[model samples]
Target chain A: MADSFSLMQEQYAKILQTYLQEKNEIGLYHAQQFSKKVLENQISPEEVVSLHLDAIEKFFPDLPQGARDSFEFLLEVMMGYGMAYREHQSLRDKQKELETEINVAANMQQTFLPKEIPSVDSLDVGVISVPASKMSGDYYHFVKDENNCIGVAIADIIGKGVPAALCMSMIKYAMDSLPEQRLQPGALLENLNRVVEQNVASNMFITMMYGSYDPRVHHFYYSGAGHEPGFYYNYKTDSFEELYAKGLVLGITRDTTFREYHKKVEPGDFIVLLSDGVTECRTDEGFIEREELTRFIHQYKHLPAQEIVNNVFYQLEKLQGFQLRDDFSLIILRRKV
Target chain B: MSVQSNVEVRTEWGIVSARQAGRNLAKEIGFSSVDQARITTAISELARNIYLYAEKGEIIIEAVEEIHSTGVKHGIKITAKDKGPGIKNIRQVMEDGFTTSGGLGAGLPGVKRLMDEFDIDSVAGEGTEITTIKWNS
Candidate 1:
């Protein structure tokens, strides 16, 4: 009995030492646990308190009664401190749970993006999509229709993070369900807008550009929904022209009609599509003008389509000192006869 | 006028591009086959380091001309820079057998021995930059 009492005495001494040195919640938790253990061992609370006081008194043999009373008061306060520590631990655990949940959601968002660009006949396609953070507000998708015409869609969500990621996945599923609609850019955008208007939140909107290229006839059909204008490079003339259509952002108006534009793509000509993130890249002065981006396309017109996409992305990323503040996406389509 | 090419060393793709760019520039500078392999290997190591330690970085390949006391020397210089957690003990890190990532611990020392000139600049909490050169003999 005496031996077990001595061991319990030593355990309390160590707990008090830990609390004094580290002053952390873990140490206080240990103190509280030790006190409970003493009470369970048939020792009265007053006896447990006296035993702890005796241990400290052994270290300070000449301690005054006033000091002893204050030490006794501190022991009562330690009980309340332990309860607060337990609450803090639970809160920390909750925060960790939330962090892991966010990571899983981010990974789910990644799978919505196109795994690979389709190999279209007589056309070279290049795509570059970079998210500003773990979740992207920008989206790009590709679908090859029955007639071998490739359909391309580039979109930008109005916000970032989980909300944007969720909207993108919805867009992906909606587009997948309507593969036949890919042939007509106007109908495709209209169908997509209706889906967005009915399903997505009222405050949320999406800007998008959809196009289809028929390699046999070398004809391209495109439509936009308040998206940034893409450029067409005429290799023969060595000139660049912007492809524009009038429309409203999706989820804005149910009755909105998108204008479909058509152009005959000649051999060596290219079409460039990008989100506003690429056009609104911040510079020391301000946002870079869209004319500069077109000029870049004209300058690097000689390289392969993929190389041109890479070079332009590198130059834009460099302009912002390699830190992208928004989601950036660019797609290039070249007619290779 | 100077001709240079840059590849962002973000993944394996970047490493391959960096190595190809280095090898091509070395060939253009008229380096022998043995030197071309050495320069390409050095670029591979540096670019891999950026991808492993720093998530992303840039590799710049430039044509260099050095007017030394011996003669005018033409060469190719490759610079790899990244904004990442800089090496704390650079000297220790460069030792042949010391490694933090548990591979071979030979990347830095191997790069130093492969090139004619090697330099590294790093600041804790800031970033790291490594530059190497291969000269035509």
Candidate 2:
């Protein structure tokens, strides 16, 4: 460090001498080149000022005390600037590290989702989950067991980034261990709530909606844990009804009970399950009402289940200026038989 | 005597600065470590709310003194003000498990729980201002 400082001092002195003698563009060009060299060596602005002062003192031993005092003040100002610049650089590095970790966590989260949406003879299903950021706090899973009961679960962690991703993995493993509960939406939620309460932090919680559709019975049994209400489209009434269930969010308590609800599905009936991102979509006006969301669904109800979700997502995405404010997850299960 | 600090909350760094300013004021006011943590946490939530929803805002931390019939009470007050798109439904946002940000829905309610006194004023398209105080007991 001392050797580089001395070398830089020598170069600075030479540039100063040339600038004072010629006072032309050639001297200015050399000064710029010297600055580039100093930057490459990571010499701070204060250090450069110090080197300049050294050169000035050497060149003029009888320089006025007032002139020297100004140099000292300039040195102090440069020192503060240098410190702030270094601090900013370190903060940028930390932010980059955080971004990389989130990307890795996002990739790990992708594996937790169902690789393929299980095809059911009686149920036409479609799902779309998009994260506003690299790491998603929203999670969804599909389980098709031996009896061919299609179990679907959508959950949102009350947090974001790495911690949410870790909590999701825990939920995924906990759900996988409960094969019997898959057919019982309320029971599944009850067991998952226990896992969350025991494992996760007190400040963090998760809201989830889980449901299973039995093709044979044409019944969809669902449960919710403080989640946003979903919509149930009735073919007979040609209207939508809210799917509401009252329960505390998971991780709040170990003994909280989630109530089970069911709806009979006719040939043209469908169930729309979604995270709050769909219903609370913000635009120039404000949050879109649930009725507006239902209208979007009704408009695209004639298309295939997947097409409907995709189109709804596009419309909402457009409303928000093509930038989602939160993690968006939507699922539609239409009875085709 | 009242000492105030202002932090402009426009980015992640702004949230950090607001938290630091709140902690400093809380410490100077002789708040216990636990209370100081709570104050800082509340400030963090408010500052983050501005960064996320409002895009830009200001957080002011002030040492406050209130006089009552019994005695003089010392406390710290924090005010977060923003001119971004204001909340359309203040009641819904204050609910414990209602969040549009896909977060833990603990934003405003959590702040309320941490502080002794809380108040919020918002106008759609105008802006929002939240004032909260925690008295040393």
Candidate 1 has a DockQ of 0.01
* TM-score leader: 2
Q: Which pairs clash in the backbone of model 2? A: A158-B104
Q: Write the per-residue lDDT of candidate 1 for residues A270-315, one digit (tens) a residue.
A: 9999988899899898999988888777777788888888889999
lDDT of 1 at A207: 92
Candidate 2 predicts chain B with a TM-score of 0.93
TM-score for candidate 2: 0.60
For each model, chain A TM-score? 0.73, 0.81
TM-scores of all candidate predictions against the true structure: 0.54, 0.60
lDDT of 2 at B100: 61
lDDT of 2 by residue, A1-337 (tens): 3347677888889889989988999999999898888867867566677788888999999999999878756764554345444444544666899788778878878988999999979889999999887778889999887788898999988766667778878888988887654458888899999999999989888999999999889999999999999999998899999988788899898898888888888999999999988887899999999999999999999999999999999999999999988889999999995
* Candidate 1: residue A322 Cα off by (Å): 3.7
Off by over 4 Å in 2: A1-43, A48-69, A180-182, B1-137
Model 2, C-alpha of A325: deviation from truth (Å): 3.2
